[model samples]
Target: MSTQNYLVISALGKDRPGIVDELSKAILNIGCNIADSRMTVLGGEFAILLMVEGNWNTLGKLEEAIPALEQQLDLTIIVKRTEARDSTARALPYVVDVVSLDHPGIVHQLANFFSQRKINIEDMATTSYAAPHTGTVMFSVHMTVGIPADLHIATLRDDFMEFCDTINLDAIIEPAQR
Candidate 1:
């Protein structure tokens, strides 16, 4: 079997209607497939991260086209070649949810907690909003972490809860749904 070539592209620009359309069309036209992507508008800016798959020649073609596409779409585009992820470690996926009064250092502290335990945080997102009824500012964090298969879940849960309690954060850790 032939090996697949991959490119990770990140683009940022002013929010506009046709950026996705134009960018996707360009990829399709270049004979590359978007393997995975995340696109969102933050404030007035549009940001996109895409992992594209193709053969070497096709991906090279896409790379050559990036400069023109950036100008046309009014975006700052970055492209990097990458290999597919290695899944040999086979870590179990777990989801962590946290809510608390809005404040700084939550993410850093949470990251430190997992890091100390040698857990890998695969994905995370955090948001802040006004709480209902009281209009109190609230923060929420959702994270997917890869736990080593040999780790004791019960002990980890106990420690995680204890840490959260000490920090005045409501949190839960559970296996990720397949």
Candidate 2:
């Protein structure tokens, strides 16, 4: 079997219609596969992170084509070579959900909590919005964390709950659904 080469591509530009179509079409035309991707619009900017896979030649072609792509799409593009994730380090995936009155440092605090415990935060998303009735600003966070298999779940949950309480945040830690 042939080995696959991977490239991580990130692009940012003014948001508009057809950006995804054009970008994706270009990748396809270059004979590369989009293994995984995240796309979003933040304020006025369209941002994308893509993991592309192909044989050596195709990936080289994609890299060579990037400057023109950036010019055509009016985007800032960055590309980096990467390999597949190591699967030997096993862990249990847990979902952490938090909501509280909007305040600064929530993300930092959460990051600290996990960091102190040596847990890996695999993914996270946070948003703030006004409450329905009072229009009070509220912030919410959803995170996927990798808890080392050897860690005790019950103890971790207790500690997480207590930590959240101390910070005036409502939170839950549960096994992630497969």
- List the global CA lDDT of all models: 0.96, 0.96
- Estimate the TM-score of every prediction: 0.97, 0.97
What is candidate 1's TM-score against the reference?
0.97
How high is the lDDT of residue 153 in model 2? 93
- Superposition error at 58 for model 1 (Å): 0.7
lDDT of candidate 2 over 1-178, digit per residue (tens): 9999999999999999999999999999999999999999988999999999999999999999999999999999999999987798889999999999999999999999999999999988899999998999999999999999999999999999999999999999999999
- Against the true structure, candidate 1 has what lDDT? 0.96
Tens digits of per-residue lDDT, candidate 1, 10-91, equal 9999999999999999999999999999888898999999999999999999999999998999999999999999879879
Looking at model 2, the pairs that clash are: none
List clash counts for every candidate, in order.
0, 0
Q: List the residue pairs that clash in candidate 1.
A: none
